[model samples]
Every structure is written in C-alpha cells, then in structure tokens.
Target: ILPNVTIRMLLISTIESLSYDSQRYLGNFIKRNDLPIPFTYYLYNNETNLIDYKINFNLLAEVQCLSTEHLIIQVGSPTTIGLESLNTSGSQSLRSGCIDTLFGTAQIDQNKEKSCIIFDVHGTILSGINDTIILALQQYASLQFLYVTEADLETNFLPSMINNSISKPTIVCIFDDHYDKHLHDEHVNLVQQFTNRYRMKNWSHVQWFLIPTKNTWLTQSDNKQYDENERIQTLRSQLSYILQKINQTIIDPTLFRTIFQVQSLYWSLLHYSMNTLNYDSTCYFEVESELKQLFNDLSDTTDNLLITTPISYLQSKIKQNQMDLPRRNKTKFVIDEVQRYENLLKKIDQISDHTQFFIDLLTKRTYMEVLITEKYLEQWRSAYEPRLRSELINEKHKMIHLTSELKRIEMLEKQQKLNKSIDIQQQLQTAKENYEQSYKTLNEIDTKLMNIDMTIGLFFDEILSISDYNSY
Candidate 1:
C-alpha cells in the first residue's frame, strides 16, 4: 500500500492453458501496478509442467522482506502443479528467519574484521534490483552485510555518512535516477559536486561509484521484457564486480592490528621524551618510570605479533605462492606486510637504543648530582657532552636511513610497474624518469626530516647544556 513499494507479478503458465484473454488481463494488471519504482512482471512458460522450485523459491524470497508485493499465478494442469503460493509463503518465512539469525552472527564476526557497502539512492529502490544485488553478493565469501546508511546531497550530508562508517574497506554506490545512456545534466552536476567533495578528502580506503538505476531503460526500450532482463543482468554484473573488489581489498586483521599497535607505541614513546624533565631528580625518576613502562608495553606487543603472527602469515603466504593461479592483491599485501614487519622491528630496536641511552644518562646525572662542583662540571663537559652529541648525531642520521628505506619501497613500486608492462624499453625509460623524480622527491623529504630531527635534537641538546645543570 506504500506509495514507493514495488510490485512484481510473476506468471508461470503453460502455453496451452494461458489463453489470450488471461494474458491480456495479466498485462492490464501489470500496467495498473506500474509506478516510478518500476513495478514490473516477468512471465515464464511452464512447457514441461516441471517447476524449478529452488530457483523460484530463491528469486521470490530474495525480495520478500522489502516493501514489495508479489502476485504469483500458476496456470497448469491441477495434477502437474501443487499449491505454489503456499510453497512461496513457506520459503519466504524460512528465508526471512534464517537471514535474521545469520545477520546477527555476521555482526558478531564484524568485530574481528569489518567491511561495509553503502547505497545512496535518489529515491526508493525496487525490490527486484535489491534481489539482484543480494544474488551477486552471495557469490563472494569475504563480502558480508555490515550496515547501510543513506547519503543526502541537498544538505551536503556525504561527509557525515563517511565519518559514520566503522569499517576500513567501504564501497559507496550512488544510484542516480537521471542516468540513462547519457547522464542527465542534473545527475552530472550532482556527481561532479559529490566527487569533488570526496576527492577533497582524499579518502583512499573508500571506493565510490555512480550507478544508474535499473529504471533508466524503462522508458527507453519498447520491448519491456527484454529490457528488464538486460537491466537485471547488468545490475547483477556490476554488483558482482564491486563485491569482488571489496572481497579482495580486505586487509588481513593480524597485519592491521599489529601495525596499529606498533604505531601507537611509537607515539607513546614520542610523548615520553626527555623534555618532561624538571631540575629535580624526582622528575627524571618519573620519566624513567614512564619510559620503562612504555618499553615493556612495546616489547609485549611486538613479541605477540612478531613471534606468532609472522609464522602463520608466512605459512599462508607459502600456500598462496604455491597455487597455480596468478597471485591476488592479498598475497602481495602479505609480502608487503612481511617487509613492513621487518621495518617495524628495526624501528623498535632504534627506539630501544634511544630509551636505553636516556635511562643511562639520567642514572649517571643523578649519581653525579651529589658531587656538584667545578670538578663535576669539567667531568660532565669532557665526558657526557661528547656522548650526548654522538647520540644526537646518531638519531639525526637514523632519520635519513628511515627516509631512504621509504625511497627504496617507492623504487620497488616502480619496478613492479615495469615488470607488469608489455613494452619493456618504453617502460624502462618511464621507470628511469620516475626513479629520478622519486629520488628528487626523496631528497626533499630527507631535508625536511633532517630539519625535524635537528629540532628534536635541540631538546636533547638542551638537556646536556650544563648551564641547566649549573643551577644545581
């Protein structure tokens, strides 16, 4: 009874029994039900009087939960046909119950690894089109229903919608009613506006699509039956492609969790810097306690991820590598993650070194604080200052080394492009240019990093300034 509800009337009849008048009546019924959401009908001739109950049940059940109505009529010999309406009713009940249970289970699984698909529609979407999308998603294992939210352009509502998404791998499908073979000017303007907003944010993780509604071809095609079939098929194909992308793009949870934990540890260390020191020994003691706690937490996190996770990852990578098929992006991601784990380990080792040096410096300074005299100042200037300068220089050089490692990764990416390209000579030339450009870019990054490192070094250098210690 809803104004936007779609109505599909399916007629399954034998050619011998479905008389001209019955067909005419069915056509009139369809015409009466036709609305903006494309209330459509499909006819299947039951020539052999054999019903594919499973396919019929699934197709019927797919759209049953939506605000749509289906009028299914079976016209065959009484002996050949059972009560199909009853069968459809039972199937719908079974499917709806199962879906409710399964959706709950899927939500629980989402806590471990969540991904989402968002649908943005100009108006109401028909049940049949939704049914096609469900069928397509069913083909992929990694895809699951997380949640759906509406996006409104009139209020500039897209940014809020994006922020509300909890999952990392998100796909947004914006269905425009005004898109035909050529997009309407209004639709084009809307797409441009939304795309500009999306691009401004540079949302790398979320994939965006502007999809034409199935009803676009409704008025364009004279043959309704053929056009509807084609429309549904096209919808199914597009859905499959998008779902497959989401499936492939899923990040391995172990790698994601590990990376996040490590990055958090790094930031925690940054906050635990020597700048927190007052001239009092208790201040140094407080920083040492916090630094030690950070080190313990970092060690525990890295131990769990590095020891157990990499072995499992390597085994999986081996299995994927042994497979005959071309490697998927996930396999490549695993390889990249292995490399990242190595980088993280090195960075952690560097952090450990820095932490240990500070700990030792604090202990020695506190020990000599009792003997504060001209002799102590001379000993500090001669002994500790060179060590402090050496450590500071080492820290500055480490930034350069880290930046080079990033440059190497960038070079590897260019090498990958060359490996995939068909024209080797041309690709080599392009790669050379890219390498040169990347090298130049990397030098600029190195300079910025050096400047940042110098700024940090000033803070450490201030700690060893001796004038600050002279106050004691």
Candidate 2:
C-alpha cells in the first residue's frame, strides 16, 4: 500500500537540446505506460530551472531537478555528478599500481576498445556470467579491472592473495556513494574532487546508472497487458546464463553475498513494482532469503581451488619480462641489512688510521733500540695501564722487539755462514715453527673460552646452574 501511494523518481541528463514540447510528449508517453510511480524526470533544458529538483543543486546550478522527494537517479556524464557520489580507483591508476588490472590491460588492447567495451556492473558484469566474460576478455587483451561491491574483500580475494603477491590490494574500490555518511564531509568532497580530477583526464573514467523498475497499474479487463511474470522470467534467464557460464568455476563466498545484495536489491524492487513492498518494509526480501544458501553453494563448490588470473599476475616479473607488472617490496629485510653494513664500514674506517700508525712505528724500530725496559714499560702503561693491569706488550714495544729480534737473527746468520755451520739456521727454523704452532693453539683456546662464556650468559636467565658455574 505504501509502495503504491506515490513512487517518486527523478532522472537527470546533461544534453542541452531537450525541447519543452518533448517534455509534454515525455509525460504523455510515461502516463500512457501507466507508470506505477509518480515519475518526474529532470533533464538538461536551458529554459527550465533544474536547480530546485536535483538533490545536489548546491553545486551544479543550471542542470537540476523539479521533484522534491526523488533524488538524482542517473547522471549523463558520470564525471559531472554521478561519479561525485563514489570514488574512482580508475583503470589508468590501477594500471600504474599493478599488473593485470584486466580492464586497464583491455584499454591497452585497441581491438577490445574498438569493439563494444561495456563496463556492466549491475546485471551482466558482476555475478557469475560477468566473471566469465572478463576471463574471456583477458584471453584476448591486456586487461585491468577492479571489483566494486559491498562484500568483504578478505573473504572474496584471500585465496587469490595466497596464490600470488600481485593480488595484494593497494586501494579501496566500491560502487556505493559513501560508506554510510560516517565519513567526514571534507573527506567525501575530497573523494568527489578526486574522481572529477580523474574524469577530466579520461571522460570514460566513470559510468553510473540508476535502473528503476517501470511497472503498469493493473487494469481490470486490460490487466493482461502487465507483463509481471516476464520480469521474473527475464531476470531468471539472465541469472541462469550467468550460472551456466560460471558453472564449474568458483568465486569468493563473500563476493556471492555482495552480488546477492545487488540482485536482492533488484529483486526487492519487484515487490515495489507490484505495489506490494516498500524499501524499508523488507529492504530486499529475495536476497535476504537466499544469501545463506548462496554462500553454502559457492563455498562447497570452490573449496580449495585458486583463480587463474591473479595467479598469473603473481608470477615473478623477471621470469616473464612482463612490462607494467606489479613488484613485491623487500624493504623490511633489505633496508635494515643495508643500514647495518654502512655502520660496520664506518667503524672499520675509524680503526684503519690507528692501525696504520702502529705499522709505521714497527717498521721504524726507533722505540725498542732506545729501551730502558723500565721507560718502555712506563710509556706502555701511560697509554693503556688503566684498561689492563698486566704489563703486556703495546704496539710501540712489540714493533721494537720484532726489529731487535730480526737484527739478532741477521747477525747470527752472517756469523754462522762465515763458520760454514748449518746448525744455527736449522735451530732458527725449528724455533719459528714452534712459535707459530703455539700462537695458533693459543688463539684456538681463547675462542673456545669465549664460546663457553657466551653459552653460559645465554642460559643465565633460565638456569640457576649458570650462576654456580660463574662462581667456579
């Protein structure tokens, strides 16, 4: 009863040439059709004041509506006002971001563009049949497309994500105007501005349609003229064709619910068309009824199988040499390693100059020859005694000692050669071998001790035995 009371509607167009005489003919044609609703169309006319009718007259002044209740249903150029309601993650932008935005890929294909390229969202494109068409299109062209439905993205695209990295989503895409007004007005305006900005570049960037179900008021004798059943039959035929195309194929169960909402909304409009149900009365009875069933069916069918397209996108670009392909980010791993390596190189450079000075002192051999052992020890102590209590060799003293030892060896060798004795040479060789072996063994022992200390420290928190070992 409420649905029949006064079904108000308004259709907005941008064509400037619609004549005033055409308006009366348009009204008569609509009246002759016996439209169930009180339909009021607001089209572009230079003579008429369209501002008062269009819901969004705050901006587009001259192009407006006459009906107060009906909202702006359709915009001729989505760029004008229709797209203002929704955001555009356009195919071009989609192309820039990733590989295989199938629609964007299609845009690259001159053949597909030259042919009929319809972005059918409502009836033919979204559910089952639409997916098959998209798949077929992909076979022929480089395509870029994105989904814009109200289903859970995680539920719909998760399997594709698992199969390939290119499936990672970079932006949000939706068919709705705004996400329930929770979004700030500023943000909404920004999104409109964003869409307009893109539309200016590609007039085809956006497309919108508000499909109102036209119905006739049932007449007593002539009521047979109302093809009510034809509507259901047509809807069924379209749905069946889609189901047939997507027969063995599976889609995200979440996508089913989303697609179901679109279908259900259309289905609910049926009751409204018949003047039996209103919008809030039962939002979308048909969809609400079958959603769970649809979910179960899709879930049972596609269980573990992955889609083919996103998987193709996920393949490594180096392997394919595919241009405009999506790339994976290894930032977390590579960036940290690069930073650590740079810091290590800096520390190495700081120690290099000190090492060079020590090398020079050894080659010069001046400090050891001047030795008073006490004075040599005092100088070493002044440099490092606070850090280590032991009177050990410093770089200066070590160099001096090596220089003195070499001099002694030379003197002994010269004397032994004059005497024609091999004993001194053999003895010196044996001593050098023994000294090298001792140094190697000492280094090994130090390493072993360090490892044991490290092991104990690692276990110290968990093992009380570590404290006892430390005491020992």
Candidate 3:
C-alpha cells in the first residue's frame, strides 16, 4: 500500500506507456489487485439569468495505514519523516557507516562485529511490523540483527552461548508472545522458565529482553490503536536502553588484542618451562602459583594486570632445583599445567597494557634463567670437564710406570737372594712404596671422575639462588 500520490503517479506513468486498446483492461486489473480506482467528483452550479458553469473535482482518500506510511518513510521517499514516534539512543550518531549485519543461522559462530542481535524466535522477518523494528535497529552500526528460527534457538544459539563459544557482547532482543497484549499464562511460564535457565548459568555480560510479536503489534483492531501505539513506543525505549547499555559495556578491541598477546607469551613461557628447561616439580609449583594469580585476575574480567611483583614462589623454585622429582610425575604435572592454562585462555576476551607489562616481565625473568643455565653448561664443557679428564689420563700413565719399576726390582731381588745383596733389597722396597702411592692417587682420581659431572649443576644453584637474583 503506497502513498495515494505515489500510487497515482505510478498509474499515470503506466497508462502513458500503454495503447488505447490496452488501457481498457487497466481498471479491471487495478480492481483485481484491490487498488482503489481513481475517480472524480464535480461541483454543481446554478444560475438565474445565464448559465454559469463552475467545475470542481474531489478525490477520495482514507487514513494511510501506519505500516505503509512507515515503509514509505524508510524506503519510499528521499526525505525522512515521522521520527518523533519513538525516542532512540543518543549513540545514533555513532552508527554512521555500514552495519555488520549477520543474518540467518549460518553465521551464529561469527558475531564478533555484533553488539546487538535481534533473534526472530517467532519467525517475523517477513512481516511489515518486523520491517519497522529492523529499520529502528539499523541506526546502530554494531548490530548483527539475526533471524534465528525457534528450532535453531534451542539447537544453535542457546547452546553456543552456554558453551562459551561466542566472544562478542551479548545484547539480545527476543521477539516472543510473552509480551503480547493478550499474553497467555503458558507464555508467561515459558518466559520465566527460560529466564531462570539463563540466570542459572550466571553470565554476567549477557543482557536480553522479550518483546511482543509482530502480529500482536500490527494486527490489532481499530479500537486497540491507543494500546498499540503505547506498546510500540515502549518497544522503542527498550531498544534504546539495550543499545545504550551495550555501548557502555562493550570492551575495547585494543584491550582484547593486548590480552591475546599476553596469552601467547604465557604459552611460550609454559613451553620453555616444560620442553626446554625440563622443570622439576618445584619449578612447576612456582608456575602454578603464577597461574593461580593469573586465573584470579582473569576471573574478574575487568581489571588489568593483577599479579604482584618479584614472583617469590618462582624464586623459591629456582633455589631448590634438586628436589628429586620422578620423571613420570614431572610429565604429568606439565600436562596438567598446560590444560589449566588452556581453559584459562578460553575465558580471556580482553587485555590491558598492565597485563602486557606483567607478562613481559615474567618472560624476561625466564629468559635470564635459561641464559644462566646455558652459561654454566658452556663453562663445564670448555674448561672444567676437560681438566678433569686430563688429570685422569696423567694418573693412569704414572700407575703403569710404577707397576713396571716394581716388577723389575722384584726380579732383581730374587736373582740376588743367593748372595744376600742389601742394595737390591733396598731398591725393591723403594719401588714397592712408589707403586702403592701411585695406586692410591689413581683411586682418588677415579672417585673424582665419577662425581665431576654434577659440579656445574651445583654451581648453577649457587648462582641463581642468591638474594640478588630473587628481586629480578
């Protein structure tokens, strides 16, 4: 139902394009489509002495339907009109460009651009009343404006929200019969039951409201016009309030990006601890402490960096590297820590500069520890281990020489036994004493060889456990 003038213009343009023979069918075609036939009413004139013909024509019209008027106001004319019907949010100026609207059930997973979504739970997308609601919502650039079938609402939308898959702000408008003028008792129960279900989940950021269906608003009798206008105005106010709330509550993209950056660094730190450092149970305890503080901060969802300075638990773990944890237990601990962080990361949707700073500090500390380990290992390989090996080799040569000398002296003493030679006996005793001393020296060297590998590790503890490193 177009405006009366627009309909006349269309009729005139259509008639001009047709031949005279074809024009005969136009009136019947207009009646078939239920369009009002254009007609004229002439004024009558009367004269006493002379006949004076005064002519006038009147066109019949009815009150233009609100739905048609609103439709024309939106798409029919270039100039906007009739905006005084509903008061909208003040942020209308903020929604100037193209809106990122994701329609249908296919885009349920990709709604990061959506700040407000209108779920058509009752299938009102094709209705004129819904078109008006959609026009009202188009003032916001951040709105997703989805049409979720009732079946999809249960299977997709609700489940996705509950499973923590959607990351965008959850400002939703649910169109249901619960808010209808002739609302049924069962409708009230359904609304209450679903509201309780969502409340039980305790999603702090979620905000949703139920409104009357399209037919309830537009299909009322003429007697209910006042009530219909009141509901429509109320609907406008609700939409305005929800969108305003969304504007106030939506997280900044920079914050989310920063948060993800810290998350990546945190994972890198964990990877280093597990794979590169092969951290013992004590080390993992320190990691868990850091995780505890991180988890608490993330749970709040509004704060910046929440972990305190110095990380005393990690410092303590560095001092006690020789706690002697079993390999199997160590592996299990790492896996558990990984799983914990995985869950924690899933909950992270925003971050701040403070969080980035905190994670950077943690990463730097771990890097320094790695550097210290490498330095100690390098020293052992370059100097200490080689020196120990050289000493062992020298002791082995001395043992062989002394054994040969003792055997030679014993042979000479046996040869001179018949004459009872004192010189040979003295030589045999000196050679045997030298052999015994060499054997004792070689045994001491062998003992040192067995324990030499652990010296550098102890050195690391001594260096890293000092109070100076604690503050770092």
Candidate 4:
C-alpha cells in the first residue's frame, strides 16, 4: 500500500486561480485494483512560483485506471521532472477516483459577483432560514447573482464549482444539525488558517461561518465556502456568504451572530463600518430554473389526478374551536393543518401563474433540440413532463379535498361550540389524516396514470386497447 501522504509541504507561487475540482491532467491514468492504497491529487501550473523548493516536489501526476492487482500510473506532461517518487511494501490497497487540481489566479475577492464567478457556492446568497432574507450577501453587491445546489453535499458540490468555474462567493447552507466540538473547532481553525496563511491583501471580512442554528447564517464565504483540504469529504457543512461588493453602511445582523453560530465576521465588521440597519433585501427564486423543474414534472401528467401532497400538508393544521379534552388537541392540529394546506395550494397556484411563461418557454423542446439531440430531448420531455402534470393534478385534488375537509372541520368546530353533544373530534382527525395520506398517494399514482394516458394517446385516437393501456 502507498503510505498515507500529507501536505507535509506544498510550494506554490501565489495560488493564482483556485478551482475546486478533481485533479485534471492533459492525459489519462491506468492501474491495477489490488494495490491497496488510497489516493488524492493536488496540482499547480508551471508558473506556480514554487521554483525555490523544486527538490521536495514529491507530487504524483495521477493514476488513470485500476484493476484487481496492478496499480498503473500515467504521466501526462513533461512536468514529471519533479513528481511523486515513492515505493511501497505492504498489503494495503488504493481505492480510487479522479483527483482534480484547478489552480489558476488566486481569487481574493470578497466581492464574489465581480471576481469569483467560476466556482459559485449557494445558500449564503439564496434564502435565509427566515425565508424573508433572500440573497442578502449577493444582492448587497450591484451584480445579479444565481444560486445553485446539488442534493449531494460532498464531492459533487466542489466539483460542480470547478466545472462551472464558479469563483463567486457562494454559501453552502447546512441542511443537517449534527455537530461535534472537535469538528467545530476544526472549522474555526480553517477559517483562521486561510485568513492568516493566505495573507489576502485588502481583504476585510472573515470568509466562512457556521450556522448550526437558524440564528446564524451569513451570505459570506466564511459562512459556507472555505478553502480547506480536510473538508473535501468531511460530513460537516457551514452557511456561506461572500461580500460581492463592499457596503458602506451597518452590516445586516442577519449576516452574522444572532441566535447562533458566527462563522462570518461580516456582521461585526459591518457595525464598525456603519451603524444603520439596511432595508434593501433580495427577492427569491428569481432565476427560477429549479422551480420550473417541479413545474415540468407536474406538467407531464394527465389531467385526472388532482391535489398535491405538499398542498395537503400545508393545509394540515388545528383550529381555534374547543373540543372535549380527549381529542381536542388532535382535532385542533388537524384543523390547523388543513388551513395551512389550503394556503399552500393557493400559493402554488399563484406561483404557477407567475411563472407560466417560463413553462411555455421550457416546453418548447424544439428550441432546445436546435442545440441538443432530438432523441435526448424526447426522452427528457417524456420523463419530466408527465411527472409535472401529475404534480399539477395532485395539487388540484388536494385543494379540492382540503376545501371539503375545511368545510367539514368548520362544521365540527361549530358542532362542538353550538350543538354540545356531537362526537366529531375522532371523525375530524380521521378525515385529516386520510386526506393527508391520500394527497401523498395521489401524487405518486396520478403521475403514473397520466403517463399511461399520454402514452396511449400518442399511439392511438379515440379508444385505447386494454393491452396498450396495461403496457403504458
């Protein structure tokens, strides 16, 4: 096995350009699988300014592929003049993947919108935990900002930054609340290390911040995006915020310490800069591509399915009506849930109407196919549109059902208040749960049903054969 190597020493000029990516080679790698050794890569360009320590430059160019026994190394460029020169003697093995090295100009811009546009992070500049504080960090800058995130929070994330060449200040929001003192301290250490080691000139704000609770999240790189090697695969996350441009007034407390973690130093700095609360906040989902995905998924379904699960959930709630102690709390919850669901359904519809034009634009795969393959677009539409249609139908159904549920609940509430002896609480809870369960079930079933119908229609006219229906 190859001995675990540390960044015992790395020599570079100024890290000109930093891209969070797998180590890139102008060529490829080949190796056998049984060589038990773990591997990673770090690279720098020729002008990396590390000419003085050329002798200890024990860096591996990269291994290409692996088999069960032999580990193969692929040297692509002439820079192998000073690469990893190691020999091993052990039963250890190297499980492997690509190691990316995207080194270019060292980005020192706290103003992400202006400088770090290639490796963008999210959450810091999207919506806050409070929802009202949208894109606070990025908006503070004069430039328009875009927020992106993948469900996978580890490797997929940084590589995306590299692929997109996103150097912009982005916030990687924490979706989970798991924590450790050692881990937290590590993050704190990283924030301090980069600030001190990199010695960024004219840099003002601390770059990263952690938001273990809702009270702390800043649109700062310190809040989320940190340049640390140990964090590459660590299961920890922080909220990110980048100063897109310098602000002249009191920094938003929302960007720094409040009820929680203080990963970014922006809030503290802002107070010293100016002491006035700022009002210019951000509007959310402006670059509604993700929103459109949900729309697309719903649009693809047939019309029969109605009422979405989210709508039902939103409607789930308790009312102010009194009930017998045995089931009053339960009934109240149901009533409240129903009201919330109704409001959400209304909101979804409102959103749909607001963005219908975008849907029309997206549905025109003809335009997309001009740049992509027709077969691919066909597959995408078939896969996505029916799902979207099903969502729409399910949402409609929820609104319909919830509207009925609400009326029943109101009656139940009134019965308890006016007609003293009605045992409606049990009935109310049952109704609410049933509606909630049905709403979820319908969304799943509706899409399948719609797909079946659409597929049948694509093949024939008035009547669909039983065999065809079954096949779809």
Best of the candidates, lDDT = 3
Per-candidate TM-score against the hidden true structure: 0.24, 0.15, 0.24, 0.21
Q: Is candidate 3 or 4 superior in lDDT? A: 3
Which of candidates 2 and 3 reaches a greater TM-score? 3
Over 53-168, each residue of candidate 1 has an lDDT whose tens digit, in order, gives 12222121122111111111111111112112111222231222111101111121323323221111112222333223222222211222221122344443345433433344
Q: Candidate 3, residue 374: CA error in Å?
A: 51
**Which regions of candidate 2 deviate over 4 angstroms?**
1-116, 119-121, 124-131, 141-143, 157-172, 177-472
Tell me the tens digit of each residue's lDDT in model 3 across 13-117.
465467654544564465456554332111223445542221100111111100011010111110111111121222322211111111221121223233222
The lDDT for every candidate, in the order shown, is 0.35, 0.29, 0.39, 0.31
Residue-level lDDT of model 2, residues 1-472, one tens digit each, is 3432222222123112345444434433433453311121223445764422211211111111110111111111111222322222233221111111101111112222111112222112222213322232222211122333323222434223112212211122333333223123545433354444445332232222111112121222343444445434543554344334332232211121111222343345433442332222112223223322322332212321111111111222223332322342654544454455445433431222212222333465343221222222232223333322222224334445555665676678887776755777775676566556555555544433322221112222213322332344
Distance from true position, residue 411, model 2, in Å?
Answer: 99
The TM-score, computed over Cα atoms with residue i paired to residue i, of candidate 2 is: 0.15
Among residues 3 or more apart in sequence or in different chains, the pairs in candidate 1 whose N, CA or C atoms overlap within 3 Å are none
Please list the residue runs of candidate 1 whose C-alpha ends up more than 4 Å from where it truly belongs after superposition.
1-151, 183-193, 212-220, 251-472
In model 2, the Cα lDDT at residue 127 comes to 27
